[model samples]
Target: MTKMIVGLGNPGDRYDGTKHNMGFMALDLLAKEYQTDFKMEKTFIAEVAQTFVNGEKVFLVKPQTFMNESGRAVKPLLTYFNIDPEDLSVVFDDMDSPVGRVRLRQKGSSGGHNGIKSILTHVGTEHFNHVKIGIGRPKNGMKVVNHVLTKFDSEDNSEAQDGIFKAVDAIKYYIENNDFTKAMNKFN
Candidate 1:
């Protein structure tokens, strides 16, 4: 069975380095490690990359439909690939977790995240896996929208980068072992 790993983020260079783009950033790290690259798949409205982990086929995806509308791309990709929701793992930012932290959940609600909400709506379930990287909540009365759209400050940048690396490692561990529980135990 092919495992589908998805990272949710807005498309374009304008969104690069923002807190919300952590998902995309994590997949980029994995791509570099695997010596693979994403090619835009217009039909799916996503950037797709194929690779192998312990000889298991894996599809790395970055939805290009923007954040709130992620389902627009994800639903089609999963349908076309014929991958079950159970075989899907989504990585995205979580404002509730502190910087430098990553959390893995086998199933859960969106926690008020629009991207996850979209996925849940289109995918029709929350039974899939989640890999959430902490972006922390807005600081000093900063608005939530601005907090997610902006790049981290110098101090936060390093911590955020660390979280991204950990996320990538966790995903790789899951793909190789084919066990979500073990990956969570080892990396969460």
Candidate 2:
């Protein structure tokens, strides 16, 4: 099966440096590693790049539908490509983990992330792989929405980059081994 990676984030320049857009940035890193670029696909309502990893074809995607409605981009692409969810992987930011940390999971609930919730609903299953980069939750008196949408600090920005590199390595491991568990064990 062709491997599919869906990186969740809002579209446009306003969201450029926010932690919420970590997924897109991570995929951007992957694209750079493969020396490829994304082209906006009207059919999928997303920016997509195609490249090979360990001789396996991989599709890197960034939904143009924005963060809360990412499923709109993901579902159609999966259908159009006739790709199975088992061969799919999602990369996104997670507030539950601390900065500089990431966790890989084979399956899980959305953990209240609207983008992930949308994906779960559209995909009709929770069995795909998740590569979550830590963005950290809001401190006392801060709102969740504001925290995610805001740009990261110097410390968090540097740490998030570390997490992105780790996520990229984890992705290569997953692609090479065809095993989510192995990626988790090594990178999480």
Candidate 3:
């Protein structure tokens, strides 16, 4: 049974609303809509919100650790909850996809996402579900780091919001049906 949903991002006012924090923003919206509150949990190095969906217990998590260290928190949570890799889902930003797109995967490599890389490194596997929210690429060949940390412009804000909502829907579908292919076909 799926037990944990982790959102990857850096923590701090400065990072809020940045493209890199899209995962956290999406998860926050989900928590708010579900009327759940995330409480600080040092053991997991994250803020966690608990709720039941379709009669299944779900842990909504936003790691407090910086982006590159996200896995440090995730590894322990999986171990503590006795959750297998298949039962975990991670949400994170992707620069390759357009701002309005969301991609869902059952299991795959990190695709060079530092946050995901960190998680995989700690957990020693890449076989886990993931929802990748698109933030769009830079105008030119700008560095990915700078591009991801930048805030969305007025033109991109609406698309970003759309992506977040779609991601939430995909998560819901995943929990309700355990059908990753359906979520991917519907959302991606």
Where does model 3 exceed 4 Å of error? Answer: none
Candidate 2 regions exceeding 4 Å error are none
Question: What is the Cα-based lDDT of residue 61 in candidate 3?
Answer: 92
For residues 51-147, write the lDDT of model 3, one tens digit per residue.
9888888889999999999988999888998888888899999988999689988888888899999999999988888899999889778888889
> Tens digit of lDDT per residue, candidate 2, span 56-175?
788999999988899989999999988898888999999999975989999999999999999999999998899999999897778999999988887678898899899999998898
- Which pairs clash in the backbone of model 3? 71-119
Local accuracy by lDDT, each model: 0.94, 0.90, 0.89
lDDT of 1 by residue, 1-188 (tens): 88999998888889999999999999999889888999999988899999987878899999999999998898888899899999999999999999869999999999999999999999999999999999999999999999999999998999999999999999989998999999999987
TM-score winner between candidates 2 and 3: 2
TM for every model, in the order presented, reads: 0.98, 0.97, 0.95
Q: TM-score ranking from best to worst?
A: 1, 2, 3
Backbone clashes, candidate 1: 0
Q: After aligning candidate 2 to the native by TM-score, how far in Å is the CA of 141 from where it should be?
A: 1.6
Candidate whose TM-score is highest: 1
TM-score between candidate 3 and the true structure = 0.95
